[model samples]
Target chain A: MSAALRLHRADTQPPADLAGEFLARLDRRLHLPQPHRRQVLDELACHLDERVRDLMVTGVTEEQATRRAVEELGDPMVLARRFERAHVAPRRRRIMNMLMVGLASAAALTGAMTLRAPQVTIRSAVYPPPDAVQQVPQKPLDVQGLPPDVQWGDFFSLAASTSGKSPVVHWGALRELDSDNFGPGHSLGIDPLVDQKLTLDQFLELINTEKGFVADNRIEYREEEGRLVFATTHYFDRRETRLVTYDVSELLRARLGGDADNPDRVPGAVHEIADLIRALVESGMWDVNGGSASITTYGTKLFVRVPQRLLPRIEWVLEQAADAHIGAHQGASVDRRQGDPLHTPRDGAALPPAAGSSTVVSVQLQRVDPAAARQILNQAFDGVPSLKQCSVARWITVDASSRTVSVSATQRHAEFVGRLLTMLDRPGADVVASAESSMQVIPLARVSSETMDSLIRAIAGGSTLYGREFRLVANPQQNSVIVEGPTGVVTALQELIALLDTDWEEPAKVGAAIGR
Target chain B: MLHKDAQRDQAELVILSLLDAQGPLYGYAISKEVSGRSDGQLRLTPGVLYPLLKELESEGLISGSVEEVHSDRKEAAPDAAEGRKRKWYRLTARGRKRLAARIEAHRTWRRVIDLFIARDPMDHDQKEHGR
Candidate 1:
């Protein structure tokens, strides 16, 4: 018996009543083996006893301490459920194991099928000679005298008989191509058979389009010892899926600004860019729209897989979009600064009267305390001439409880206030105090070091202190980028890398909430 | 109040690191140590603490041993005969390895988050004006 038990024995109204009742409830709910249940109850009882004893030492009465200890342990039913989940949930484990086994078996089967070669049959066919063969002694067989299918059969049979090498027919490929519905009229219409002495390559080329038995550019052939092997390149073959990764971080950085005001803004921007690319490019070429192409993003880079021919088009669209996005920002900034009527605030705020347009905007602080943020905003607004003219102090309101600030001022002054609030509400503002240079090696999991190096350079180049205050070296062998700079910049770079190094696969939802 | 899910995620690493630093400790001592170290911000209730300990023990990351502790109230009460049981848990070799990996992961996560919240140094003028 512990001191707690002795205390319980001395008092008629024992504090142990609360703990004992809680344990009993827990014991009833636990579905564990007897020994395990006993062990758990014993451990929890010991913890409760210690807590009650410690509280009693602080001058609290036995009953109060016991009740407090029991309450702190939480509801006995919840604890019992957690215990059961930890020790008795074998059914969930069994289901997960079954799923793993099923997936492994499926993957293994797919691998085996992919590795297996298609079977080819070597055979020769001879077609009966056409009637009235106006045998021009040195000339090739005249296809104009017979039906197209028969003419092809006659030429093929003759070529197979004389070539010494048996023709290896890919029956599976032939059936597939035939099922494509390429009817009789889709022939190459070239007369390679016009000359009697044609090379093997010339003969193969002619047969490549014979009544479309095999479509042009889809057939590949080579002489294999005593046989000629022919294979058809299926359009849906895995080999046809070309993976191209594009570094679009620079373009995004330019459009969204070097430091985005909203944390969600980066993802939103990425989504918008991806959507634009998908919409501008041919719809029939993407996997999302039932095409063979697929687009995925990891961090700031776009990973696109389409036919080799579609690569040029995708690149062109991204380039055009980047140019348009950057140019729009520049043009909009200039127009806004000059108080051009055409570039008025989208909120329908009235244009400025000689000085500047005035608008009322409410900004909710995400990271900073609203009370402190308002005090700071008040002082900053007093210095701006345009804001002062609009009587900024009278128009600004801060609601600390809701963490929001509303301000009415000239367009430029209002925009400045919003930008200031964003800067103040940064996540780790305290950690940026150290300006000492430090070297950090960031190991990239998805993007290559060379590619990351170029992106880092692009970002660093935008800074005024690039070569002097900051420097970076990419180690391709290690697949890591070594950045030497002030702790703040390095920290920012790491955050940027983490942001850009994600696997974003859903093309439809990428940046879907842009203007909203 | 911290979110329950977030608290649970941090609890594992905190427990592992505590055990590694302070050696073997029983349940109550572990709870007190955590609360004391974090200035009472992290109070590991029995519900969250016990299940995690049991799970860790089941996974062989930590090992628990039961000890019979005799009461000092023998002279005060004749009916108190059976000694109470106190289970002490210690970090296993596997737990130490897990702790190292978890610490690295945590540091990387912190660095990323810190950077996300850090203000641009180029905007020093704005900060000064606000001040």
Candidate 2:
């Protein structure tokens, strides 16, 4: 019998005297008769007698000892409580075990041990696409993602793949770290590169080859006129060490309408930019604010990071180019842009760069709500299966078109794209390579805010963003979309817009760089 | 031989009250007292008390000490020699207090009942005569 049940038995009779020993002290926790009490003593007789003998050593009379033992035993209430707690879990386990036993017994009576499996499947969905809006002329086009000012053959000019890669798995789900083999019992995994294992060396090697950089970037102060410009320049680049002289002096002298400040920065490409500024002014597109022109310098590529100022003019030039090339000469479907959130920016015209600098253009919409911006970003991953469910909030996105890198938010989204960058970043995450990918945000609210007037002010100012395009404008009437981009880029942009609209049924949001 | 536990009622009132208050006791310690004074009955049972102790414990209102029961008896039969056991318990404070109060209330009832025995024989007869 369980110890608990025995203690519960009445100690009133049987060895009725012994009953006095345990029962007397037994809390009248339960009221019982002579026989019932005896039953308790019978069960506890051995124990009671042992206690009696123990009291004998305390120097009491034999009878007294037995009685004292009973008295010393104290409260039955305490004993009852004690016994109950000790047995609860065991009792529960026993009940489960007994249930299992009963099931097994019934099974034995029949004789079968087969089990059945469950079924599973995969699913997908897509929304409607949008229409294209009108185009605003572009002055100096945003040529980013096309590889520095160098002439590119095509988008796939540098399509090379590297090997020695490992299949990635989440640390939480690593095979060797299986729960059964975990805890203090297990030692280190035998092979570093086992099924789900990765060695630090192999991981680091992957990062160096794939990630390409491990240094922290710093912002340098350079004097543009008398103003201190907070700009990030890779001063460590080996090429910056050499002070090479080119015919920049002669070019600056011939091109400048006024005195030049810095002489050292001039030379090869600076001379070419000086010549270009003269051409834009002659064409009358330069917007002169007071006596100064908004001159910004940055590399020109399909996804280049142009300075924040010239984005308006650059957007304008791209629009003009696209207007000229798209539809008519570029053909009906040639340089189409996915008019996802296409609109003309309200900013002044493009102007000449500072004396000797190659002008870099940039555009940005200020106070972009993180949520709206995120929703807009979601447009990029719409069709891709893995990224369809990816959180726009948590993805490390690089807008090759805008030259801006926004950090991904972590927890909110669970799509494969959620971990894409993080997994590709540090040594642990085995990202094979890093490349530029451009995407347009949908919904003006998704880019800036649903608040219209402020969004307009934000676009025109152009000072809010680092490298952003003009403000996005929507003609609630025609459902049109207009954007500034090279004719080909604009065409592609239109296709992207159409894909979104056709897939999502959203009206076109056109973007261009108009006068401030 | 079994007449040993006759004082159980007397001792029980006190013990139950303590159990009611403190709730659930270990074997040997339950044989000792935490609160409440002893009656003249020399009734302390470490051995036999354990089994019955174990019994009432199973009935639930009270639980028992789980930490291995150690026998502090320096000299013990091998059957009982799992030395130096300590007992613990889980008691609803309500149960202990109630038990403790019940013991006191029961004693008061017993004292009232005793008044009948102390009454004059004639009065006792007349009291029952109301029937």
Candidate 3:
């Protein structure tokens, strides 16, 4: 017999009744398998024995040592309850094992189907009402009898047909312009010559020449931030640039997995943001001069050119977006006067006097302009709920002339003073903005080659992007797995692998948490 | 002062750090080391330590195996037979990396907090008065 069995059978001095009682209670409460249950009890017994020996060495009696040891281990019922919650019952595992095997392949096909189905239905819903659509005037051209140098007024028109007759090109209004008059319906007088077919590019060139605005329209297909991005830049003002970037990485990864029918199609959420931007522009909300924006899958960050007069509308829109639970951040300004130092806040004058004399704080932000300094103060105060409750705007004054922000409040508001000073000294935007794409190769220890291969198969079967976006290569030389992909996906995969390697880990929890 | 939840969260880090510093150790040794290192400020009961040990073992961060204690190798305990077996746990490569990451995060947090604490307003006010 083993030493553990011999000790149990010997039964000397009633075997510490406190420990025996605790073990009996734990054994009854525990839901672990028979082998695991025995192991746990033996470990607990060993721990108790060690504690008792240590305590007795310190001059404690046998009974006293046993009692103290049992007490230090804590209530057996609580430990048992925690262990029960942590253990995965064998029956539950059996059921999950069966379900995963059947659903693995089906999930891949269904996941792909669901991804491509709703996009078409959601496209129309993304557009604004009919009234919001800008209207362009339409005119037909007559080619039978016409003077060579005819005066075409506000609208450009040409008569053309695909049949073997002289194709007269008729130019219709491209799009309606609500405010800037930059959209369409501007005049383009052409020099009349022998009537021939004119290509679309030729017509666009003519319009570009006639209009002072440079028609810098460009479309690009590229990958950004782990998602495929199709960008179209329409330049209305040479001084301003607008980036209405949409993050559809998640939506794409979710929908276009496992033999998706149309993997190249754009996601619905991207289309929605594009449509919203167009509606906003038509509604005369594109009042800023030079601006750009990045609308991510979950967050929206915008940089708007706000004239002094249009600040109220921008504030109102921001408030509305906040109420809707939309993540929006106000980025750089597009004011031409401040264009010399791009991305930095505009400078301000000297500091103003405080309202109260109880406390006075004057902070100088070295390189930042007054307007930007004020914005930074507002955002910092807004970040902390307690400071935001009292409203930082009421007590603090920003001075552009001396480049100093003075805060005067009562003695009780000294906390605000401390927080504001810390903000001035905290890390700048440059430190916060640097994010590098990380690539790592983690060696799998004690995990069999077959298990790793099975994992690779499951992932590739579930997600269609396995070969393209995300690549998992097994390096036998290093006895490790090299996962190379976008930082987010690779990190997620690494976490999943760690979870899988855990012996007592709940496979269901790991499966459910992983997107694939 | 750490709350119960905060202490529980730091349990994994403490265990991994101990394993990295002292090599393989059993459950009781790990618990005792934690209490001793914290100068009795952080006391980990069996209820907390055992569950955390099991979790870390399951997470692939640490590997555990049973080691037999023979009379020839070390002093045999008086209570039981000559030979006894105890499970000992050692940190895997992943466990070491995890410990390093958590330590780095704690260091960064401490640095930020120190910056705020060091910039005492009263000191600034006194300096202005002196000027």
Candidate 4:
């Protein structure tokens, strides 16, 4: 007989009641098999032996000491239950919940297709962007002319089919002289600034030659936080003297102390701003196109060419100069400008205030602008409820501040809370069905892998999320696996909110209270 | 000759005795069917107050779990922790079934001697002890 069995041979087995409870708990916590549960107990026999030795020190017989040690430890069932309850706290539930919601929302908008790629180190592995090729595809193609359904690529929330003809590229828009005339048209170009020093006349003509680069046309300006935003439909043609024209708002914004509602009236100021930009580019005082600039006005009427790129070489040097005296920023005559509306119409008609308008909360799924970031939660969630309605926005923010990845949820009611009671039982990557009716936060484990895939795909296929570039990723991120892909600010922020919500979890009552 | 209450007074002792002599006792096998032999006076509750057994164990006395069960639920779980969960608790090599069984042994003797008195023992007590 084995030494272990032989040693246990003299001992009577535990009652089925005690044994059964111990086995069940081991399975749930360690994901061990029943036979495996026996091993755990077997391993504890050594602990039992040491405990018996301690009892023996008190002069008890060896057998009596061991028996006393095992007895004092209590039934294995009670111990198992105690360990399980202690190891898993409620906080982990919150993390998992947030991860699910954030991922779900991204999935909903991104065709719910999980993309997997090896973890590519940002510093070590670099690939030129997919569309970085200089040579363009077949041109003069009309994409909209084709049937609307011929879709390719995996951005489910948004779809695109460009006519090999004129490209309708518009990620950013600026300058609306007349909202009526300014439909949703966007024009951009990427001609590097200096070919050779030219008089003021040459610069104007260089910009005019490019498609839609003229003064009356609209051009995009950078946000307060400057991001390197590459635009489409813009091409560069290297020519004699290489003339390039870009919006000079960044450079001019600096000239005007940050805000230039208008920039045309101050004639002499315009000339000076233009001259300064010319000098900076010619002297190579700025990085090749890195002095970062935008088109702006000196004041209400003084048009000033400006650089908007963060950390421009030119701006740094200028600041260092003892006499950083450039031209004086002057107040020009005013020209009243039209302003955009407080709330743009959605669903074609302006959205009427529904009942419980005060309770109508909007959470941002994607950032429209800073002001929109603070929009009503209901309005924000109007189209993207898969994420925001559970309202983990605040919760998600809080968690990220405290921990790295956390397992959490935003359950609304108690019955819904039952969905999670079983999570302790599930092992491996699971898409647990969490909740069906947004009314109660009843969570269910994934009906199956296939079911989860279809659900995610169905939701994701319908959304028009932004910045979904195709790349490979690690396993939890692949088909039917949990994955995290690089997302644009709009999607990233939503995820951040989802992360924040899951930490300190709530029961289903939260949703019920609000829904009621 | 055995005293009338020899076995009844120390049931835990008798159980520990049975377990000590014969490796272990399942819940059903312990403390029963031997009742008639115990002068028809000894009775053990399987369903109620089983807690006494556990209380005895808390003091480092006796212990068990239903390990080594043959049921389908038991066979599937291959881990020993699981099997031990199925296996019942038995005495370690050092336990005397009664930690210091001498104490329980004396209590049994006292109870057995007491059984000698008549039911309305006022007559016997004055008669026996007064002598």
Candidate 5:
């Protein structure tokens, strides 16, 4: 009789004592209702019996086969755990469901409260009053009699409460006036104005002078409607002009012709350089051109009387000229004298050595647009110390009308920009000469020709900006694409087509199909 | 080594596909068929197979029916008490649809991975040099 038949006949009787014990252990751990437990045990018993029968057919004795089959079934506890995981909801999941419901209830309650409390303003408790207020007449307080060591807050509060004229503290203007005056943790105490006894007007003046708040008449006591009113001034009312002396002796020496030793040439070179400065700098700001800015020469120096904002631009132009002249005459030794100290337009800090020195060069782009070239050069030179010290965009001018980029940068920066521009401005003739155009017919095996055609068109069209000329035609009849383009683009397309034209296969089909 | 979770998911797909191909099969028969087909390289031990089968059946992807195995002896009646019963499992209609979706998803995932693998590193270096 077949082993399976023999096993079935044996199953009609009670199972072997060992098999029965294994089943009982599994049944105990199953933790199911009687009907369900019986069903699972029956299924496991049938599986064990069949396994024993198969093993017996392979020349194993019945007792050994039964033991082997039981051993292969694995630990009953582990099997029970697996069965429990499949059949029952885990404790963690049940807790998570309860937590989710709790959160939903809280959210719903909050939403209902929001709908009911629509009129709530929710304003901050510590709202700051407006920094500036209209001047109002109030009785004067004898601030001079106050103690010298009084705290600033108490002093201001005493003055405001007694005189009924609260001092309008322009905090932003104060920070701009002198950031160092208010040191760390000194916001409530005016450190510089401490330990001083003066009249109210004199005290305000001391605060203004000691803190360097006198610039642009920012802080002052003015008599209006027969009352002394303290106010901080605004620059928007009028533009301030300042006289700055730039020592361009090095630049004047470089501009001198063959008659370098002539005394007459010195004045002429100075005037010429001065005129060039006036022409190169912002025209609208120059005084001679109906603007506030004016330029004149004194020996080898250029005295420029312009608005405070125009100082940096004039300095940038002179520095560029000096750099170019010095670069042209390698052996030239020109004297560089420090100019008078001037406040930087940005933060009014003392100016550093003419922020940046650059050589001026005009490039006529053959292919790249001037605007695009400027963008690329800006990105390349971003975060450069010299570029960051001064404004990069100010030194680089793009003339889209003439397709020219005029760059005033240091020699190293100039060279980098030139090389980058050369790479970017790839003319059709240059590309053809360097890497000749080629024709490629790539067959589509996986993707449709129409799909690849559209994809190649989208990809290759973007490459045209790099001076890569290409034409693509999809041959639907043969399921192929014909490409005629620069060798690099064609080769790239070929690589892309080869990669994309592939059959999709499962990761480990053979191994997975082998089953384990 | 495959993670336990990933191995379990792969086993689910394999089992579903097997049932679709082989029709109704008892637990032991299914295990034997898998072992034989894979040349003993894959062994679906009872502990793994029974739990996965139960889970699949609970999910409604597969349905099971109990069948009685009568003795082959001529004297045995069809309704005889001398018979051992076994549960047979077969793929439901939902199971077939799920198998098809899983296969498509696996192919798409493999295609994406192959795209990255097929890229030539030397070509990428050359392109970078050209730039």
Candidate 6:
């Protein structure tokens, strides 16, 4: 037989002496007559013995069989009670059963009452108090106390009214009355909504609306030069007559820094000049606040608007800016291709430096429209696709009608443009030649001599950037890394250096001045 | 063996049915016969079955007689020389009627249990419609 079956057979085995012991226990518990007790014992003994015999047939030991047989009969006390129930007087049985029923019902009632009772809960702490309200007046506090000599209220009143000389005069006289009265916290921000990209006319209109100036610009095509010349006049409050005329043509030619014989050189130069004009004007425009004038460049001229009293200061600032441009142009290395006979200047030797230190210089800009300027720029870029690798393109823009260009790029881009423009002046130089000639020495700034040496070693030995081929000369004496390669590669190194040092200054800032 | 209470109520029926089927049987023989018929699932001991037998005899559902018989054991057997007297029981007319009634009640009970145990087609239809 299987192990489980054998175990089951053993489990069902009757106990050997269980029946005899059970009957004795029952007999002691039972209240029966003598003859009846004798008869019951005899029958029960025979039944138990027979049960054991039957269990033995199922392959259980006699002892186990007898035990199982007696166990099957249930507890002795319980069995004796059952027997008593069957044989006892009916009246007594009824009383016992009634008592059991009464006890059960009482327990059930107690449980139901316990479940129906209301539950008790512990509450949380009270809510927090509200915050204090600020005691502020709805309208602004009136201007009360004032110095006898200065009329700050009079100046603001004039400012809130007509855009005329009275307001400008009062504001300036007040400042002159007490220079330090407003304290160091009196700085003002006069930012117009110039966040969106705008054309020169739109920008001028916005300035006129916001700052209350009258700006008028005109582009005239000259048959003699076969190109257009742009000029703009600015009047203060639409009343002042003595306007400043900013001639961008000379500035543009100076920025281009080469002979204009090479067709490629003229367009690139025009683009750069327009960019430089736009940059200078935009900088002057946005940075204008107290005692500052608003200026903008379109085509070949910069228009300025300022109060009569502040006109001298504005002109002085403009002269200084012009001088800076002249200095950078004169400092630029002469284009070696100037001697190339085929690429001789068509309009005489009118190079950037030849413009002289005149207060105002004018020349023919480009005859092309804004679309043509973009096409030229795109053409220029097609020859030098690597320009797209860096973010320098966003800083330089071109306008064909005004033939104006603007550049607000980093110092690196400026240097690259300088080199590219110089190369483009060559007779046979295309965009590629100009692009390749973008090689220039980039000075490292704010780097310790030790760090500079290590970086130079890392770059030269090809270890710092994996798989990058770098050609760099480390000048410990100057504390600069002079790099000569494609503009993109040079820019990558610049970015890497920037990543390494947050305080690192642009090498272009430390190199040749802005105009150059 | 069933629970004591259930055994107390059904023991008389079991004995009557046994006697009706096997004819007259002594106490030990009846017990052995019960165990055998149930494949040893039910066993009645002296303490339980004896009282039930006496109750049945008093109720007139069964009648008992004292029988003197010779032992069928071999001469070498331990109790062969000793003759024993045993009380034999047989189902009376009233006992037979009671047994038949109880068996019918059991069949009715089985049918009632089937109502819950078996899957009703109406229940399946109601569930499908509800879904």
In terms of DockQ, which candidate is strongest? 1
Ranking by DockQ: 1, 5, 3, 6, 2, 4
**How large an RMSD does model 5 have?**
32.5
**Candidate 6, residue A107: CA error in Å?**
30
User: Model 3, residue A45: displacement in angstroms?
Assistant: 1.2
Instruction: For candidate 5, write residues A272-299 as lDDT tens digits.
Output: 5565565555543456546656777776
**Residue A503 in candidate 4 has what lDDT?**
14
Q: How high a TM-score does candidate 5 get?
A: 0.31
Docking class of 6: incorrect
lDDT of 2 at A55: 62
Give the per-residue lDDT of model 5 (tens digit) for B1-131. 13774476567778888898989988998888888989998878888999888777766679889887753421222222456669999999756654664564456446546766956889999999999
Instruction: Give the clashing residue pairs of candidate 5, or none.
Output: A287-A293, A358-A409
Count of clashes, each model: 9, 145, 19, 135, 2, 22
Best by TM-score: 3
- Candidate 6 per-residue C-alpha lDDT over A454-514 given as tens digits, one digit per residue, 9 for 90 to 100: 5444323442322233445444333344443444554555544433222222223222233
In order of TM-score, best first, we have: 3, 1, 5, 6, 2, 4
In Å, what is the interface RMSD of model 1? Answer: 9.8
Chain B TM-score by candidate, in order shown: 0.81, 0.50, 0.73, 0.49, 0.74, 0.74
lDDT of 4: 0.32
**Per-prediction DockQ scores?**
0.15, 0.04, 0.10, 0.01, 0.14, 0.08
User: What ordering of candidates by lDDT runs from best to worst?
Assistant: 1, 5, 3, 6, 2, 4
- Residues A297-411 of candidate 4 have per-residue lDDT tens digits of 3332222223222124333322322122333222221111322111111321222222221111112222233232222222333333233444422321111221211112222
Error of 6 at B66 (Å): 2.2
Fnat of the models, one by one?
A: 0.38, 0.10, 0.21, 0.01, 0.36, 0.22
Model 6 lDDT at residue B121: 86
Candidate 4 vs 6: which has more DockQ: 6
The per-model lDDT (C-alpha) reads: 0.56, 0.33, 0.46, 0.32, 0.55, 0.43
Q: What are the candidates' interface root-mean-square deviations?
A: 9.8, 19.1, 9.8, 23.0, 14.0, 26.0
